[model samples]
Target: MNLFLDSFWRSVAYCLRPRVIALSFLPLVLMVALALGLGYYFWEGALDWVRGALESSSMVNNVWTWLQSAGAGSLKMVLAPLIVIFAVTPVIVVLSLLMVAILMTPALTLLVAERRFPQLERKRGGSMLMSLMWSLGSTGLALIAIVISVPLWLVPPLILVLPPLIWGWLTYRVMAFDALAEHASVEERREIFRRHRGWLLGIGVFCGYLGAAPSLIWASGALFAAAFVILVPLAIWIYTLVFALSSLWFAHYCLAALQALRTEKELAATTALAAALAPSQTTIDVQALPLPDDTTSDARPQS
Candidate 1:
């Protein structure tokens, strides 16, 4: 609990740093450009496809006709675009997180190490290639979980529980590994993971819930079509900021945990060495104590 709260406040403070704020924009810009490029080329085609799909469903078409007759035809105009946005929101989120993990995490970890754990040794437990592969694998699994859980989403309680859990697992897996990659050896990293897995996943799940806040903004973007150009970037920026905070949180917690691990090991070693020497020192003390010399005991012998 102390570790969790310590890292949490530290992360919140770090997010306010000028460097951190500047770094966040990189992902936002990349996502915005990607969004714009795709919108320019495929926007119409995607909307048409969604509309066609909606139209082909007799039940939906009947509902649409009723809505039109009820003088709510304006909803039809936004529905297709809204569907497209909803369809793409998950992709955007996954991409934004990946971008932050790839670009921001290492730098944030370095920053935390420099400021807080400067003496922490760099053991390079994880390499760039390995980190990338791990992230991709985790992401694949999370997506699969999302797909497999779609039916379960129809259940009211499960809908609230499952996706965040999957995302939380992914967030913990990726962010914690990247945070400790440089300074902790593989064994040390594994030990830290084994010990702090619950706290780390708590942080991830909390951040996962935070990550959902942007979807509300995304919904607003769909509702107010005129503001979507602005809202899309805003939503992406929020995602970037949330991921950035998550990275910082992981960095602070993992590095601190690693430092504590080293300190504990060092203390244990010192204690072991002291114990090993105590017996020899006691023997020396016993030997150094002068034995009763024969000459000194002459009076006792005569007695």
Candidate 2:
């Protein structure tokens, strides 16, 4: 618990640093540009397709008719845009996470290491290719979980719970691995995961909830289209900052854990060596030896 809170506060403090703050914008700029470019190309077509799909559905038409009778017909205008926004929101989130992992995590890890754990060895347990593959694989599973759990999300409470849980699991997997990739060997990394899985996941889930905050801006964008162009970059920037904080949290936590693990193993090794040499260091009783020299000398003189 101390470790968890310690790392969390450290990460929060680090986020305030000029260097860390600047590093966060790198992903933000790239994501914002990519988001704008995609929005330019596909925004209209996606809205149209969603509107057409809604129009083609008899059930949706019935709901629209009922809504009209209920004097809530204005909802019909926003529904397509809302659908498009929701659909694209997940992609934005995943991309934001990946961007942090790819662009910001290494630097953040190094920043933490250099400042706090300067003596920690770099085992280079995970390479860029391995980290990429691990991230992609975890992301694939997370997307699958999201799709499978979408129905459950209709439950009001589950909606809040499930998405964060998925994002949290993904964050834990990706952030923790990247944080330790350069400093911990494969064995040490796995050991830390084994020992601290619960706390790490908690950090990820907490960050996941933090990541969800930007969705409010997304929602606002959908409702107020005029502000979308501005809000989207804002939301993307928030996502980048949130994930950057997450990367720092994991880096601090995992590196500290690695240092502790090595210290523990070294202590145990020293203890074991001392135990092995202990008997040899015991005092011997020279007086307890049999005295055969006098008898032998007397016998030789008599002969």
Candidate 3:
């Protein structure tokens, strides 16, 4: 836990290198577009649902006066989406931070995999355009999950799990992180995930939960929503840096513990570990695993 936090700040220190710092805000920029565009489209549906739900329930009914006054009803219509974003602000913030963190990951992970590996090259492949596309791609996938799990909100659990992992994986792509990794594609990453599946997911779930914390209050008032817009970019930068550094540290720890080896070689890595350390370091220790995933669910209820 301490190591993750420490590594996160340290990664931030490195990411602020004159070059990467310029592009660090890329994810947040794309996210704003995603939030505005996605938010606009979803607001109508969310409002209808809220209105329908309010008609039958005593809970939201008390606010009917507030709901219909002037453009109040219209405002209420966007409330659900606004609230969702508001409650999940922390997660969103972390997600933004994840962008910057991902940018730094290639170099950071390189250092982890190979001692004194040179700093990763900062080439622009996944641009603001790419992240927007990433958001669109991921949002489409998440929307599908939402549809399949609707009414019962089974999707919340998945949301609690998926976002951070996706962010991490996206970092994998943009940061060229897997230069040291054995797996390349989603298939390979999944395979690597499977080999050390338990811990890998544990890390993802843990980070996602924490990442999703801001969303806990996402359903709150206008003030909170305003606060969220202000806080999101910075929060995300911090969140990504912290989560990525922590995750990479955890990954390194897992590699040390799990020893998920390929069939061909008993000694998996190249000159990675010292010859002296290699003999004693071969065995992985699971007991040293870090924290659990965050919240059980967002404020959304099961139907």
Candidate with the greatest lDDT versus the true structure: 2
Which of the numbered candidates is closest to the native, going by highest TM-score? Answer: 2
lDDT of 3 by residue, 1-303 (tens): 543354445544555555444444565577666665755687567657765775787666667666676557666555556655543453455446445444544445555555422232223333445445654555455445444544443467755445555544433333322332432333434455465455444455555555555444344433365765555455555455445544455445433332333332346444445676765665444445654655644455769
**1 or 3: which has the higher TM-score?**
1
lDDT of 1 by residue, 1-303 (tens): 998999999999999999999999988889999999998999899989999999899998898889989999779888888879877877888898899999899999999999999888899989999999999999998888888888898799986788778778989999999999999999999999999999999999998888888888888988887998999999999999999999999999999999999999999999999999999999999999977878766756443
Once fitted onto the true fold, the runs of candidate 3 whose alpha carbons sit more than 4 angstroms away are 1-23, 36-150, 153-194, 216-221, 225-228, 250-303
Candidate 1, residue 260: Cα displacement in angstroms equals 0.6
Against the true structure, candidate 1 has what lDDT?
0.91
TM-score for predicted model 3 compared with the true structure: 0.46
TM-scores of all models?
0.92, 0.92, 0.46
Candidate 2 residue-wise lDDT, 61-111, digit = tens: 999999999999999999898888888888899999999999999999999
Which lDDT values do the candidates have, in the order given? Answer: 0.91, 0.93, 0.48
